[model samples]
Target: MAIADQSGRTVFITGASAGVGRQTAIVLAAAGATVVLGCRDLAKGAAVRDHIRAVTPAARVSVVALDLASLESIREAAKQVCAEHDRIDVLINNAGVMRPPRSTTADGFELQFGTNHLGHFALTGLLLERLLPVAGSRVVTVASPAHRQGRIDFDDLQSERRYRRSAAYAQSKLANLLFTYELQRRLAVGGATTVALAAHPGGARTELNRNLPFLFRGASWGLARPITHPVEIGALSILYAAVDPGALGGEYYGPDGLFEFKGQPTRLESTPRSHDAATQRRLWEVSQQLTDVRYDALAKSR
Candidate 1:
């Protein structure tokens, strides 16, 4: 798919300090979009902004402080963003945490689930008003193949019973897909122009694995080397969902190679588990209650 020129568009991307999000921000900014980098570290985000500006002198880039683990931080960042931008053309829920030592967010939810799923959920809901009024606006979330291994154990959504790093990560990724599909349904029902979509990078060489145990990280890297692609390539699936005019709501994109590990981005299928309407609705309700940010505009038809 040919990427549409984003001239005059405003794009807000989380985790823009590094990896897929960083590359996505650069590409869109280079294409003439006013890109906002939502980073936990302002210094890192400013550095990325400077780097992009140095290369594309005409690029309009801004850095906003964002920490997905803390609802306070998320709300402040969203408020700052909405106060500054009248319309957001694309909001990429691209930030995520991989397998880390068991921990909790400020809200006491599991780290991976809170930061990766709830954080984006709240941010998207807060920013929906900005997106809904804009024609062709999109919410492109980054999920993963790890979702196939995930099962949302509502009995212990926070891993209070058992906390396996891989399981937590998988659950979070699955939640991403669920949120995308549910949000799309609500948007369509409300007759909104903003759409929701998802994408995955497959095996990308990024710092997301830095939190894994040393031996496991080294072994996995060695074994996965043949399947892993560069960060630029990883960002393609996300960019496709963000800019491709043909991409539609409730769609997913990933690599075209074997096992979807590498190569060009293309439309892909997710597990049937990710498509459960009942689970999606339940998760959405839980997310709203947890985040305290309501998608009232999209909820009228629900």
Candidate 2:
């Protein structure tokens, strides 16, 4: 897929030190977009920025410190980004944790839910002012097919009652979809030019699985190796959603191959549960309250 020249566009991608995020950053930068990498480790992000500059000497790439596991870090990162950049053409909420052992964020929320969903939620809300004023700006979130098995256990959102790594991960991914759809609706109602969309890498061979147990990691690397694609391919869906002229708000993108495992990027349908407006609205309110970062500009439409 040929990407259009992104001269003058500015794209911010989280978790960009490695995996699909890193690939997306490099590709966009090469395409002439000013790419800002949001990485937990400043050193790793600087290395990636240096690498991009080395290969594509004209590529505009910079690094920002972002630790999604901590709300304070998220706030500081957003502030730093807003202070430096006047507008954001694209904000890719691509950073996330996979099926890690049960843990909690600094705010005490489940690790997967906090870092994957809530962290992006807060960041996006905080940066709405920057995005709202930009024409054709987009908030593209990265989700997973595991959302199919998810059920938002509102009763135990933090997984305090019980903890299953896979189940928790599924819920977080589902939240990602719900957030995307809801954000799109709000952006439209608020009459903002910014739009929200989502994409999934399908079975991409990324470091996201590093947190999984040894047996599962072995199965993923050995048994599931044939099904997964490289990070470059994995980032295609994200790129399509972020820059495709035909892509629309609220739309979902993923691989086109069998079970969406690997292939070209294409429009895809999310599960019906992901489209439930009621749940989406509920989740939005809850997220705002939990994160204490309100999208007042967007809420004006409500």
The prediction achieving the highest TM-score against the true structure is 2
CA lDDT, every model vs. true structure: 0.92, 0.92
Please give each candidate's TM-score.
0.96, 0.97
Cα TM-score of candidate 1: 0.96
Q: Point out where model 1 deviates above 4 Å.
A: 213-220, 300-302
Model 2: which ten-residue window has the lowest total lDDT? 214-223
Worst 10 residues of 1 by lDDT: 214-223
lDDT of 1 by residue, 1-302 (tens): 35567898999999999999999999999999999999998999999999999999999999999999999999999999999999999999999999999999999989999999999999998888788889989999999999999999999999998999999999999999999999999888888888999999878888887876664354246557788888889899999999988789999999999888898989999999999999999999999899998986566533
lDDT of 2 by residue, 1-302 (tens): 89999999999999999989999999999999999999999999999999999999999888999999899999999999999999999999999998888889999999999999999999999888888888999999999989999889899999999999999999999999999999998888878779999999988887787866664364255466787888889899999999999899999999998888888899999999999999999999899999999887676644
